[model samples]
Target: MIRTVVVAGALLLGIGVVAAQQDALKSAQAIMKANGKSLGGVLGPMNKGEKPYDQAAVNEALNTLDDTAKKLPTMFPESIKGMKAEGDYSPSSKIWEDKAGFTASIATFAKTVTDAKASVKDLNTLKAAFPAIGKSCGGCHETFRVKNS
Candidate 1:
């Protein structure tokens, strides 16, 4: 019957939408993971003197994060809009509510890293540069991310 075909088609469409959401979620997480590897894994240790600072490595990390900031917004589609952020760095539901603010936050991060790329010339400057980047990150997190719950 036509009704049966319509029902089946609707179900298939729903499933496809859900699959797309899952894929977007996975990609956003992977992008965050990569940024974390560069920021937390490498740069944090370098700042603490646990690892020797290399300017080339620092530049790479900054570049990577800047690139991420640009792409991160695309990961948050309308499909995922208003969805509660569950994980450590997942976006808050407010991301859709205040999309302009969310986007401004991303722009701030990109600007911070872009400025940092020029300022971080040596170990001492690297240390000096961290607080600004950290503030940029913390500001965004405070407004747009849900962590530890």
Candidate 2:
């Protein structure tokens, strides 16, 4: 009876770890998707506006982006380092092949937001900064991420 209880407890612990990782992964993806959508919406309206841009809104957006970048690394799949090389379980080869580039892309995005937080008080400054940040994100998507379609 004691041995059975011990085995059951171990199984539960293993499941708990996997479940926690999955929950974390899902939350991170949701955050990334929502943040991407928010950025797109801001850019679309800002580009077509003839009126002066809202500095407060731009700053708020930048703040959100900065937060996301800081949270990005923790979202990596828990099995990334231990997956079978020949199976469908390996981490993206691009990530391993160009680790420095991957890090740099995210770092650049974070820096853009940090700078934008300070420069967004002016419409012209924000106009310049916003496009630069968008380009960094686009660069990453072009090289590393695949589209769902």
Candidate 3:
């Protein structure tokens, strides 16, 4: 009876840990999605030339992206790789398996955002810098993120 109780307790503890990891994953994914929305809101109109670019809006969006980039690497700790919760987008296992590579990609993205933020003084500069920043993001996503369809 004692052995059975101990086994049951261990199982419950494992489940709890998985649940916590799933929750963390969900939170991280949500942050990334929100950041993406912010980027899209600013960049979409700029790209389409639908309206005159607003420097203040570009700066604000880049700041948000930079902040999120800084947080991205730490968000996907090893424990949460395969775990999923409601609305969670699971990262590729490559993130944990090739952690060094993943970290480098994130560092590159952060640097790209920083450089873009620094160089974006006017609409023309922003238009020039945005594509490079986007490429950096796309490179990381191609490797570390799962494609949702």
Which one is best on TM-score? 1
Candidate 1 vs 2: which has more TM-score: 1
Candidate 3 overall Cα lDDT vs. reference? 0.81
Tens digit per residue, CA lDDT, model 1, 58-96? 988898888888896897887875454446656677778
Candidate with the larger lDDT of 2 and 3: 3
RMSD of 1: 1.9
Ranking by TM-score: 1, 3, 2
Ranking by lDDT: 1, 3, 2
Superior candidate under lDDT, 1 versus 2: 1
Q: RMSD in angstroms, all models?
A: 1.9, 4.8, 2.5
Question: How close to the true structure is residue 127 of candidate 3, measured as C-alpha lDDT?
Answer: 78
Model 2 ranges with Cα > 4 A deviation: 50-52, 80-93
**1-149, model 2: which lDDT tens digit per residue?**
99999999999999998777666645755766666764776643674574446766666667778888897655565444332333122234465577788788888878877887776666667667778778877777677554432
Question: What value of lDDT does candidate 1 attain over all alpha carbons?
Answer: 0.82
Error in Å for residue 52 of model 1: 0.4
lDDT of 3 by residue, 1-149 (tens): 99999999999999999887877787787778867875677865786687578888887888888888878867887887665445434588999888889989988889989998889987788778878888888888888877543
Question: What's the TM-score of every candidate structure?
Answer: 0.88, 0.75, 0.84
